[model samples]
Target chain A: DAGITQSPRHKVTETGTPVTLRCHQTENHRYMYWYRQDPGHGLRLIHYSYGVKDTDKGEVSDGYSVSRSKTEDFLLTLESATSSQTSVYFCAISDLAGGPDTQYFGPGTRLTVL
Target chain B: AQTVTQSQPEMSVQEAETVTLSCTYDTSENNYYLFWYKQPPSRQMILVIRQEAYKQQNATENRFSVNFQKAAKSFSLKISDSQLGDTAMYFCAFMKHGNYGGSQGNLIFGKGTKLSVKP
Candidate 1:
């Protein structure tokens, strides 16, 4: 356990609605990442943050946005939810402390769109 | 772009038996890292083992070991004395070597291999 927790472990909402997921960590890791897991596609990176205010897009960054104002919290928001966005989202943290950048993951959140 | 491939979609092995999962990757860069992650029914991703490209010797963690064939572009995981706890979906991932501030730390993962440990 990396002292990571994801809020709203499960959510269901109608299409076109706004949805936001939160990831909180106690390790004070410098790198935090968000990923979506789908059948046949495995886990795809959605977005990541390196520091308090620095962020970058990942392989699958469309339809999603993220922000980090503090070291312990990273938020992922779906501006408008869609059926395609229904999947399990995971949050991971890495310290990169002069060793292998092994990331530890949170429990994950499952979302459904109708 | 780097790509990781797991040839077997599903596999089964009896308890106490040994089983190996196959993974192959494509990368132009000479130095990088390979990892195997296990996701049980609970859906929590656990890091099984990791191998650094710069290291010639294979990496092992308890009953889990990897066969790293750099020239062949293959990395396989071998589980000895498999237990029911090993039943889960296994994923292979790749990450390129780069500075901490760059995108090289992001992991690209394979589809996954469903391993069933039979009683």
Candidate 2:
């Protein structure tokens, strides 16, 4: 295990509500990523942070936002939940430590919007 | 842009038998990396193996090995002596090289193949 944990392992929220998921890592990795997994779509990147206060949009970042104020924590928030946003969200960390950029993942959070 | 494809939606193999999962990627860049990740029923994503495009030899980790045909844009995972523990959804991903500093470290993934290890 990579010492990564995701809070709120499962969540259900009604449409138009605000939802936030947290990813915490103990490894102090330099890179942290958020991805959403859906049937027939594999895992699509939502957002990622390279360091505290530095973030970038991924392939699917329309309804989501992310912020990292510290090395160990990265947060993903859905400003207004939508039914299409329902999926399993995963957090991953990578050190890029002179080897292949192998990313270790957290347990994941299942979020449903109705 | 890069794209990963896993043609097989589902596959099954008897315990102790060998099975291979197919993955193909399209990339114009010459330097990159390929990886296979396994997601068991518990939904924990585990890195199975990785191959660097610059390396000619395939990469292997215990019972899991990859066949890297760079020219053909193919990367396949072969599991020997498969066990029940191997039953899971396998994903193939691609990452371009030299994007270490910022947003480029993100990975592009395939739809995934479901492997069932039968008793």
Q: Compared with the true structure, what per-residue lDDT tens digits does model 1 show for residues B14-38?
A: 9999999999999999999999999
- How do all models score by TM-score? 0.98, 0.98
Residue A72, candidate 1: C-alpha displacement in angstroms: 0.3
Of the native A-B interface contacts, what share survives in model 1? 0.63
Candidate 2 deviant stretches above 4 angstroms: none
DockQ of each: 0.73, 0.80
Tens digits of per-residue lDDT, candidate 2, A50-88, equal: 899999999999989999999999999999999999999
User: What do the candidate models score in CA lDDT, each in turn?
Assistant: 0.94, 0.94
| Residue range B14-107, candidate 2, lDDT tens digits | 9999999999999899999999999999999999999999999999999999999999999999999999999999999998888773556888
Summing lDDT over every window of 10 consecutive residues in candidate 2 chain A, give the lowest-scoring window.
A95-104
Model 2 clashing-pair count: 0
Clashing pairs in 1: none
